[model samples]
Target chain A: MIDLKRDGDVFVLRFDAGENRFHPDFIDAVGVALDEVERTEGPGALVTVGTGKFYSNGLDLEWLGANRDRFEEYLRTVNALYARFLSLPVPTVAALNGHAFAGGAMLALAHDFAVMRTDRGYFCLPEVDLGMSFTPGMSALIQARLTAPVAHEAMLTGRRYTAAEAQAAGIVARTAAEDQVLPAALELAASLAPKDGKVVGKIRTDMYAGTLAALRGPVF
Target chain B: MIDLKRDGDVFVLRFDAGENRFHPDFIDAVGVALDEVERTEGPGALVTVGTGKFYSNGLDLEWLGANRDRFEEYLRTVNALYARFLSLPVPTVAALNGHAFAGGAMLALAHDFAVMRTDRGYFCLPEVDLGMSFTPGMSALIQARLTAPVAHEAMLTGRRYTAAEAQAAGIVARTAAEDQVLPAALELAASLAPKDGKVVGKIRTDMYAGTLAALRGPVF
Candidate 1:
């Protein structure tokens, strides 16, 4: 279950850790959030969270390891779901309840910003360890956003890091006190609410989506 | 005139500076070179260069200063001209001759790899210094390829550096021998020629253009 709750000027969106992740329905939920943000006229912000200790394992490794055919189906669904979150018009912050591994790590990176527990667990895209690479496109996006050295080390080696290290690597915006993580993220969202959402939104949108728009026409 | 010369297992695409530093027709010549590379049927590679000094200051900055009223017209033409260069379906290398400032800097970045001179000048995008930032889209592309510290400093200060530092910062792939820059670039292109272009092309295309095939319909 995903709930969008309003606390003060902030909109807290909570995602429940379920038996199924990245379902077609979940993808639709993300699109709805983006639409709401784009059409909203008031001052508010959105913070995404997950229930309990898992931000999301999407096609849990155990399940995928045992079910290959199902994994492919899940991948297609996961990719579309992630793309919607990336397309959101407003600034987004992902508050990782605990571990965000593999596809989960990719999800966290797609957000405009993220916060996690420094001591509890780890975050990583160990898909390479599982014998694959980031979709070429997503790999390119990571290359653009992070220093090549960091990107190369993470992808090629499939290393995991505690939340503090993720912050140091410039991926995690900040590490929070276990009790303070969501609150910290909510606070950050609240800060952006007063600022001109249009300007902030424009800058973030241009940062992520504007590049492709400019290249729309046939160059050849 | 731009010329393609072969070295040991490498094909170098050298752009010789003509009448106008980055000859107005230079952009077109680049497009033609790319078209040929595409037809070659392998992981395409090419390196750019200028005759003596300066890879290219890009768009004859001085010319633009005098033609402000017609800048819009000039820009539309240049925009159309560079479109093909940006979208070339091959992995290209920028073998910068000398100074690559403004448009010169952009042209260099469009490549998959680049080598710059260590003797003197380096890259800079001083558009913001010109009392306007007309390349909002370009800014996004550049930021993705560069480090935040480097991107922030370059865009905010408009400072230029020696080629040596540019290479270290990953702005330039590597510095080349004064007279052998073209030879070096050609060498790299040829080396990569034997690799499976299918994979390379698939990777590059996916990176630049995602399933962006239909922007209107539900992405899924």
Candidate 2:
């Protein structure tokens, strides 16, 4: 279940399903949560977190293996979510309570900032290890968010980065103790909640025009 | 004098004029240097550096102040330099030996990486204090390069950042001792020198579309 709770001007979207894989229903639930946040009127911000030991494990590989015919459409939907998060009208943060791997890591990168748990978990892109190539949209999103050296190393090595390493690499804005991740994220979100949505949205849209073009325009 | 020297695979363009302000002739000289680097055919990269106490003090305020009628044309040329540097066909790095102020700081941001002197000097955007507003082009370049919190503080406060602070803020990739700045920049550039120019150029041009649009389109 994806639960969205409101705390003053900030919205917390918590994914409680174990592992929080991007199964079709999980994706749909997130979409609904995003819609609700957008519909609410006021200065606002969002923080996404997951229950237990996994923020997300990325794609529903078993489902994709069984439904090859839907691969293209599925990828398009995933890319759209990344684009949406990248250009969200208000400030957003990914509170990585546990592991964020593959597409999961990509999703976290889409937010304005990311806060990770210091003592446990890893942020990784395992596409190379899985013998898969990144789609153009995925590549663009990562390249846009990271410095050249960091992006090159992460994409090529499939390294599992600890929180301290992620912060040093500029992958995550900050890191906190295991139990403090959500609180840290909420505090960061609240600080930025007073910004006007339209202005922030425009700045982000303009800033990431290239990444958006690749994600939203076509599979190519 | 602006000097272009080739050290193996790296082309170093060092601006030696006092304060290295963007006077008309100085801009012309830099353009000529850029043209020379581009015209040469090789697996190579470019590193821009400066001598003495200032990397660059931005525009020639005295000249611009005296020739107010030519402001529009002058700004066009200045912005074109920025756009040119931003899309340079090979990897580029700026080694800031001293202060990089206003347009100068924007120049450093245009490069693929920047290395600043650790013990002295500062990186600042003083338009707010100078009673001037940034052109859309200038604003877009800074916003595209830095994270939102850093961008907000730097733009609004015109804060002079120390080398340590700049690296921590993600404004520069690295920092070095005064005598080590240029060598560090050259080493960094050399590491990325073998990349195909066309691919790198295309990536940058596409990635920074919004900034290029504002820079190349018009004064508005």
Candidate 3:
């Protein structure tokens, strides 16, 4: 389940379901929440967080196994979500309370900034270890969000990075104690909320035009 | 002038021209040196450097001023060169013995890694200040090479970053005294020389597919 709440100028979207995998219904729910965030008027920003030990575990493999025929369509929908976050009109931050893996980690990267809980969990992309290659869109998003060396090592080695390591690698902007992740994200988002949303969106759109194009392209 | 020399497994290409601006002839000279580097067989890598005061000062404005009709074509050529170095078969390193500004800074970014001279010079992107904008390919290259926030700030603010700041911003891998810049770059390149050039090229091509496409596409 996803919960979207207003805290001052910040829209905090919390992922409450266990693991927070990208199920169709879950994706739809998050999309609706995003629609609401976008409709908000004047001086606003977004912060996404997750409850319990998992921020998000990425794709719903169980659902995918049952709906194999929808694989490409499902990935397309997921990629769209990434593009949306990447070019959102308002500033956005991911408050990583726990593990963010593969697609989940990428979802975090799609944001303007991210704050991770330092005490536990990891940010990892395990596709290489799982005998999978990234979609071109996914590759573009990762490469755009991270520096070349960090992106190279992370993608090729499928490394699991702690909060400190992720910050050092430029994956996350900041790290805080378990209880401070959301607060830190909210504080950062609040400060940025005053920027003109249209200008922010335009800059981000221009800045990530290639990434947006890749994400909007075919999965195959 | 461009000088190419073999230093162990590292090919050291020195941009000896003052300011090392990207004049058409300079571009041609650099291309010739790169051709030699590509022809090298067995273990090999590349280290691009410059003599005193300027690693490179970027575009040859005087030349561009005199030949306005060739602007688009010239940019296309520059973008192609970036694509070439980005996907070079062997590892490449830029040894910034002095200033790297605008397109020159971008050229350094196209390398696999970079070493900066700590005691002198600055890494800068001054287009915004000069009322100019990056070409699409150049934007893609910079965005792909830098972390999102760093890219945003650098491109928008036209910030001049010192070697230490550049390193912290992930613009370069290492920094050394002015006298050691080339040596550091050569050492790093030589260590990576044994990696299968084909594999390295393939991985880089795949990793930067979107960037490569943009670079190889229209200059506009």
Specify the highest-lDDT model's number.
3
Candidate 3 stretches greater than 4 Å from native: B1-138, B144-149, B152-163, B170-220
Query: Cα deviation of B207 in candidate 2 (Å)?
Result: 14
| Per-residue C-alpha lDDT of model 1 across residues B8-110, encoded as one tens digit per residue | 4345677666522544466667667766766775344556677677777777666767777767566555554444444554446777767888777866765
**Candidate 1 chain A lowest-lDDT run of ten:** A211-220
Interface Cα RMSD, each model:
5.5, 6.2, 4.4
Residues A98-189 of candidate 3 have per-residue lDDT tens digits of 99999999999899888999999999999999887888899999988887799999999999999999998889989999999999999989
- Report the candidate with higher DockQ, 2 versus 3: 3
How do the predictions measure up, each by TM-score?
0.54, 0.65, 0.61
Instruction: Please report how far candidate 3 places residue B161 from its true position, in Å.
Output: 5.5
Winning candidate number (TM-score): 2
**Over the stretch B124-179, how does candidate 2's per-residue lDDT look in tens digits?**
98765564656668778898899755775576446799999999899999999999
Residue-level lDDT for A78 in candidate 1: 60
Sort the candidates on TM-score, descending order. 2, 3, 1
The runs of at least 3 residues in candidate 1 whose Cα sits more than 4 Å from the true structure, single-residue gaps closed, are A1-74, A77-145, A148-220, B6-9, B18-20, B61-70, B129-132, B196-202, B209-220
True-contact fraction per candidate equals 0.14, 0.06, 0.22
